[model samples]
Target: MKRTGKRIISMLLCVLLASALSTTALAAEDGKVLKLAFTDSPTLVIGDMTIYHPSYAAMLAFKGAFEKSTGGEYSVELYPNGVLGDAASTMEQMLTGTITGSTPADGALSAFAPDIQVFTIPYLFDNPTIAYDVLDGDFGRQLFEKIAAETGFRVVASYDNGGYRNFTNSKREIRTAADMEGLNIRVQDSPVYLEMVEALGASATPVAFLELYSALQTGVVDGQENSCVTTLGASLDEVQPYCTLDGHLLGLAFLVISDTWYQGLDADTQAKVDEAGREATIAARGICRYAEALAVDTMVANGVQVYSPTAEELETF
Candidate 1:
């Protein structure tokens, strides 16, 4: 009886330790390993290899640069496939310095800086070029600063989450917003996404990401919108038969480090971290292009009909 009681207490302690986001103690106890976490999908592909997610590709690039720049002082350990938790949970860990950094989508980042909604506005930029130029320029830098000020995160980069969100539905091919009348669209459980769908003349239905496939299959929603990287990741192409390249929202993801954790680093180390992050950002674009191509190809192969809407046509939506 006494031994069983001790074993039970030990198990409880282990559970508590895992639940706690106490990175300082962890860093000190486990050597100089930095931890990072993100969702499972084509991004990390359930922690498997594929490298189809831009953020994951950036993470891979950052790993090597970080090791080289840090002079072998710190090594990164990843908890991919949402093993650590969802974007929101991981962001909490990062902010608390329980983890080193993260690259959640702009929607997730909005939880930190609500102004991020500005980027999510439909048709904000004409193309990826314009989006990159603006985000890689002063406007992007200033916004990152604002994010740091408002939230306790030192945002390092805004890597392309790849391509723009397009319209996908099992119902019919959508060429313009006018075609969206009365369609039921699944959106993220957020006000901004709800607004976007509503603006397109569709009723917005909020559903959890993990349950989206079942929702679409069950007729809970008629359509959805997302980047190719994610559309492929969720295997939505298997269920949704039609796609229109509306290019509505430019998929932007932010890489953020804990402000307090960053401040604690030596000046040299901090510079190296920033350098690695920048390198990751630059490396990600090419990777994003490839992943997007592959995703589109995959969808087409799977029998999803894709349409490209003209700028004037999209404006009607």
Candidate 2:
């Protein structure tokens, strides 16, 4: 009889514990949990044992700030590596408030906001400071407001997507445009990139970023170009043997939140979100200065031949 009673009490305790756990889970679900998406686009890298790409680092900083400022009532869940979906799909989700946020490439965003194309012009900014000035000035503010009015994705912050893009290949050293001739180079799925590749004397091949690594590995393309952080993050450095610091396009990434979602948040929460975004931008830039130096050193250490051509040499392309 005592054994039976003890067993019954044990069952009751188990049921109570399960109920408590379920209630806690439900409460957490009821809280504001935001889904922020970004791809593996390169940025300033932070790694010792493991690398945290710039975008992920910015996301982490934003998440930590936002959650702390909001007393842990708000949480950010990152969807990196295109797990939530491709750039366009995730941007659509942000508009509909299906996903709360995303920081897609400015090239990808240009399709929705045509004004962004101007920034993609080759060698537009002479240096990173000028790029920062333009992006953080009235021009950037006006464009963000216009985009929010048009697309429902409101820009909270903008950060450099690594430094100026450089050329990389498995085939040959690229000191001039003549070296780029006939090279089957993989370009982003955008007209600006296609035009740039063509102008450089290479046969431009459009490829989805997700498929780029395999394409390069399988001899689908002979070369590609992007910032150093991007090359390392994508592990393209392992397959590509030569890197030329061409200093082409000045890349940008926009941290955008859904208008509908932002509107739903309380004024204080909204302010906190904006503050966190700015903090992330600052943090990312600081990391980039150090990261660029380290990234090049690491690639060289890994046996990738690094070359920096003179401005006159680059103009030949």
Candidate 3:
């Protein structure tokens, strides 16, 4: 009887210890792994410079570095190429805690942060370098921090997309806004883009990026606006002929995460994660600028009717 009672006590103790260990693991007092979903298109093809594309492989570099640096305790689950949904949907998901993070263009994020939309306004910056200083400086940080406090989203880094340049399949070179009359320009589904295209006198059509090439080929739209990198990265040269260096607006992207999911992490882990994201953002931006320069040179060499408007020609807009 004594032996049996001792055996039963040992079994009960083992069970209790196991349950306690399980609870501790679940609580993750030390640290936890993080999964972040980004906006991207599923069928978007990759290129030699795809790694430098802000929304694609460049993000992967961020994810890898964060995971490796943290010794696997912290990690990201990147949903590239819109596997999660469009930029808007992805942002919504992050807000609801269904997703941990996202990278959306400033114009796309304007619906959430109106101040960010200001960057998309016409003639916002003379060039990418000036834009970068504004974004990485104290004013940008304060603005982003305010956005986070007000909107329950955290902006870790500001990413750079290529300059918002214009392109067309039509034969005429657009030297002035008057030349844009009656042109059906395909634009990303952003109100800022729509407004700007309207200002330039084109009938702007909102279309997803993947469908743009086919749209231009079949006359669904007569032209579009994007950076040199996107024009080449997407192989748009196959369809669009007249590439214009309008430099209409500066483009900016952000690596954002849900405040709720982020707050759930311990402070130390969160700091490391934030630092990693910042590094990734800087790296992605640099990669984009380099890729854009190369894309422009390559496109010019490939018989693209590249147009540089004269100083007087640029004033019509």
Candidate 4:
């Protein structure tokens, strides 16, 4: 009788522990956590760059808008500064439902959707306005649908990443394509970037965006191309003192969520998520444009040489 009682007690304790764990899990799921990850510092203004980095601000906007629209039924948790990992990894996590969403650069998306590489072609969009119009129009919706069908990811929103990409280096200022020759340049882990850099007469070195600073400081690459906002936000000016406003590529970012997860949400929640994403997109674009406008002056004030090529000189490329 004693042994039987002991066995019964053990079974009861196991059942209770299982019930407790199940209840905890259920509570967490009921909270409807939306985890968004990105790889940029929360603060952009350190010296002359006086604006909150859009990545952080926009995520906050998304969180606030979603919670407000949902009447606090959902909670958003943001992981900035690559806390969740770099773009590629975070995107993978999102794909597997390990993360709810992520804002990855266009180049990063190319890995999963090869068609996205077309956007990375140098000078695809002449200006931000054109880019915005195209992205926010029917074409953009169709493209998103195609991507969803192909990758199980839905692009919830699109926004300017930094306006335009330019070359920055510690070696010297680049004035023409000739100037790029013989210099090893760090390019994003995308073939289009590699081809673009090489076509510009530089040796293209593929590097993760998170490790760019160390790569530049250690002379792994002589230069890198990025938007002024990214250059300043990452403090690349500290490592690279020269910048040429070549504007080779129009930078863009996409806020993507797992289509599977999104489909699971009810219609009301889905609409709320879309609304929040739109708000976040606007916030990101505003800050990016503001930063781009001030970036040249800011970088110059911060002891980095900023140069704009003459039309004739620009044509030399």
Give me the candidate number with maximum lDDT. 4
lDDT of 3 at 191: 76
lDDT against the true structure, per candidate, is 0.80, 0.81, 0.74, 0.84
Worst 10 residues of 1 by lDDT: 40-49
Which numbered prediction scores highest in TM-score against the true structure?
A: 1
Ranking by TM-score: 1, 4, 2, 3
> Candidate 1 vs candidate 3: which has greater lDDT?
1
Compose the digit string of candidate 3's lDDT tens values, residues 1-317. Answer: 99999999999999999976665465355435454666554222234433445655446766777777766555466677677788898888878777777888877687898888767777777678788788879988889888888887788878667556655555567777898988999988777788889888889999898888888888989888888877876778877778888788767888887777767777886887678777877777777676677777777777788887887877777
Q: Which residue pairs collide in model 4, if any?
A: none
Per-residue lDDT of 56-130 in model 1, one digit per residue for the tens? 767777888997776556777767789889999999988767888887888788877888778877788887778
Q: Model 2 off-target regions past 4 Å?
A: 1-31, 39-49, 81-83, 208-220, 264-268, 315-317
Give per-residue CA lDDT, model 4, range 1-317, as digits (tens): 99999999999999999976675465468847788998877777635435777667678889999988976567788888899999999999987889988888877887798777667778677678888898889888888889988998888778877679998988888898899989999987777788988888899999898999999999999999888877887889999989998888887788888899888989988999899889988898898888788887788888999999988888866
Q: Which stretches of candidate 4 lie over 4 Å from their true place?
A: 1-31, 46-50, 170-173, 178-184, 203-222, 233-235, 238-241
Q: Any residue pairs clashing in model 2, and if so which?
A: none
After superposing candidate 1 on the true structure, give the runs of residues whose Cα lies further than 4 Å from its correct spot. Answer: 1-32, 41-49
Q: What is the Cα-based TM-score of model 4?
A: 0.79
Error of 2 at 296 (Å): 1.2
